[model samples]
Target: MTPPAVVEIDHRDPALQAAFCDYVPRVFRTVDFRRWCEWGEWNDDYRAFAVLDEGRVVANASVMRMRLRIEGREVIGYQLGAVGCVPSHRGRGLSRGVMSAALESCGEAPVLLFANKNVLGFYPRFGFKPWEQALFGAAFHAVPGGEPAPVLDLVEAHVREGLVSLSEEGLAVTERFGSRGHARIASWYAANAFSRPLRQLHADAWVFAGVENGTLYIDDIFAREPFDPRPHIPRLIDQPITAVHFGFTPERWWPWAGVAGEDSEAYLFVRNLGPPSGPHRFPVMART
Candidate 1:
């Protein structure tokens, strides 16, 4: 069989989000996608699409971003994800279908994504030219007495008590990066990424859940700051600490000298998802 034809879904739309909640599991359910949508986890800047065959989803793609209304003009920055084609349908046209749909929908809004160098090669065929590195590893330091405590209670308490301090800090960083043209990180959240933190399901929680392992110090904490990770050492090294680890963006956030400094780099991928102020600098996927 040629397989089912491709269909791009407007998953962001409320009706669609509700309609597809149950069916998403039959195809893709790595994260609690249905619950995320049910909890108001979406932005207009976010777009979700899929490829269907025989009326069932065989492929999917999602691009989540934030909208910046600068001087009355909307700037779109997107992070691509929720991408995969059913195994049985692999090597067919499903990947092409969903991928093409996602990129084309990006329009002239300047799409960006963090993917392995090998994967980056596949994007250009759709006009997703690489301008920088978006993927990176992260490091963490636990509080001594604090003992790199699990985010479970912390996340729960915050939600229970409206502990928006972290979110606020994260937002500040998001705003800073958004202003600097790194809008993809700050500007949006994909459903899978959104509800985790919203539910206080942090990297540490995931780690503790055996989803990963160890202290669950942290996993992927997307931020908008685009700042050096070194300065946070004092914060990372503060008293009540237990352990620290690094992954993703090693060069930038890792403790190379076991010391902290204000000057360091993090791994990231940047693209002009919107109008550019002028020339920009980004890493080539070849190096990532």
Candidate 2:
């Protein structure tokens, strides 16, 4: 058997980067790292560590330098994503090599990752403990027979550029617990994963949302200015919604009706950060 070589991929090297992107879909079928990088959102903060067997990437972990706002305090942290090992390389401890490299590069900073269901048991070996995240919701009265908001195409050059600018200038969605400098990661989901329409309410405000089970789920709201999104909710409703659920923290934006429950869908695991005492939700849009 060939020895595994763990290396930090230089994304500027086209061939090595392409090999890394190729490895992503083989492990995580749904994500498109290639398109995300190609769309020009991949910034200098993101770095990929990979285990290469005979120069072919077989296991990988990618890290991003994060500026987090935890309980109104600015924290310099790290986020791990695009973590996976090809099926053929499983059980070979290849993931550990990449993870070690990735973590070492992060130094002593706090780190976090949202694990896939199958890998819930994997992160604990690296001193990561599962963390609970709160969900915020409120009763929403939508206008009956309301017109749908115009959808913004995220792939559009102007839209993408605008969001990148807003990400730097916008106020944190929640100082209680949110993120900073996260537009790059958010663009990946906007382009590939989001099935809902993204509606621009203002020159600087955009909302990504959809209706589900009479609930209007607002996945994310990007804005450069501080504005109340509540007033614009009526324009976003395509039908009558009984309630509104926010994916990102609304402490700075809305009067949330308290914690609805734990966000079970987010399999969050962290290292170095203590469990949040009060209700907290990591900004959904900021996650990688």
Candidate 3:
């Protein structure tokens, strides 16, 4: 009998892409499969590996190429995401084969992934160790009455330049603390990370935030100068915002909040294909 072939599929191939998209819903019930399919439109740099059984995709893994600033130096790396196997194929080792193939293709680049608690014991076989890093950010009470930040068209050169400055500063802070950071922000990432039509509260500030459950979640913020959340928090959304939470640890602590220690989640893991480094922080925008 011929064994199922495991190979990397070109995302541009519509037929294979559709098959891969179709397989996702079968393995993971919680995700919006339609939105997951739309992810391919903004992300062109990813490669999908699949295990085909009888001409159908039965297992899949996605590897996304990313440019990261590790210890103040820019390095190319890969992020592993959307790893799954069909229920009937679970015990057959198809996922292991597909993951092994994907890692082999990356050569010497570092790979990062967020695994669920259920699979905590699985990634260790691939040399992925638990990454324990602190989550720092402040909680702010909505002050109300300030003008909202202007929505910058990220496609424009000047707007992009402004965002780039913020990214550099953010990297500098991470580098100071002996952590790695992502150097460049792709337009596709911004469009997906932030809301569609990409809105910002300040003209000069590049803050990627969303309002949920009456709490504003600040995912990422970058500005040429120090950003004060005071003015823009209130006007971020028309509905009354009770508080704001940040994903990154701000350089300057806001008076309205205090830093507290919290245990890191066990699902976050990393495999260093090169030299070993100290504790590192992954940007919230990069999380799958």
Candidate 4:
């Protein structure tokens, strides 16, 4: 049996750097490869590994950092992301090699990720456990007929007229919650939006500013203790919204169901990236 040649990659090493530069289009195409190449060059929290065959790159994966504050404690975790094996190496077990190496290194902080149900089934044998609610679909609220009301129009108008676009607005919103609310959203565009400016790198994300899908999905947003996502759902007493799919707490969400006929619920399969039985409080940012 030929042993797989798998080892951690130093992003700066010329050989491994060339491998990453080559695979961006095949593995992930949403963001330009240059950004990841830059990420490799700039970020210290990222780690990578490549599977080599007789001194040539065949597969690679990366471990990136995600910082979350849960229950008043600052939890800095490693997220297993940007994993892809070469087409020729698909059935060669190179994935397990890279995953095993990444899992072996996580010490104190728990590691996590979100994969489709089929992929989730593959991680458990490696000592990962499926943590419920570790994956959550949007807690949705159907607007009255799925159309933005006058108030929503005003909000869009603010951005369209390009009047309330400034970092000052974003700063004011940051105090409410980290970065997951409407206030923070408005602030995000005001500050990082390309057309506007506060932070440089995020300016490209501003296209989401004027985009009102007429649907609001609150996923890992303002997560409170016992994972109670019910009351946090904005109550629409007199308003006419079609439905609201509350998060994991479907029981508490019953009142919300009254707003619509039948709310759809979607959950993701979550598997831990640590020991056989470890802390399962892995945040939703695994998929973020």
Q: Which candidate number has the best lDDT?
A: 2
What root-mean-square deviation over C-alphas does model 1 reach?
Answer: 8.8
TM-score of each: 0.51, 0.93, 0.74, 0.51
Clashes of 2: 0
lDDT of 4 by residue, 1-288 (tens): 565767776545666666665664565554233432442222455566668766666676666554433333435666566566767778888888878777666655666654544355676666556544422234345323322211122124344223234221221111211122222223322232221122111221121211133433322222122233333223221243333432222222132332222222212222342222311223221232
C-alpha positional error of residue 134 in candidate 1 after TM-score superposition, expressed in Å:
8.9
TM-score of candidate 3 to 2 decimals = 0.74
| Sort by lDDT, top down from the best | 2, 3, 1, 4
* Each prediction's number of clashing residue pairs: 27, 0, 2, 1
Model 1: lDDT of residue 80: 69
The regions of model 1 sitting more than 4 angstroms off are: 1-6, 11-32, 67-74, 116-120, 131-171, 174-288
Q: What is the C-alpha RMSD of each candidate to the true structure, in Å?
A: 8.8, 2.0, 5.0, 10.0
Tens digits of per-residue lDDT, candidate 1, 196-247, equal 2222223321211111232223223333234454333333232433344332
Candidate closer to the true structure by TM-score (higher is better), 1 or 3: 3
Per-residue lDDT over 182-254 for candidate 3, one digit per residue giving the tens place of the 0 to 100 score: 3233344554344333356555456666677777766565544565666767766656677666555444424
Error of 4 at 229 (Å): 18
Q: Give per-residue CA lDDT, model 2, range 1-288, as digits (tens).
A: 554678787657778888898898898887777877788777778888998777678999999998888877889999999898999979987888889889889888999999998889999999999988989999878764445567888788788887777777887777776787677777888767654677878778877788888898887777877887777787788677889998877877786557899999999999988765578888787887
Error of 1 at 200 (Å): 11
Q: In angstroms, how far off is 164's CA in candidate 2? A: 1.1
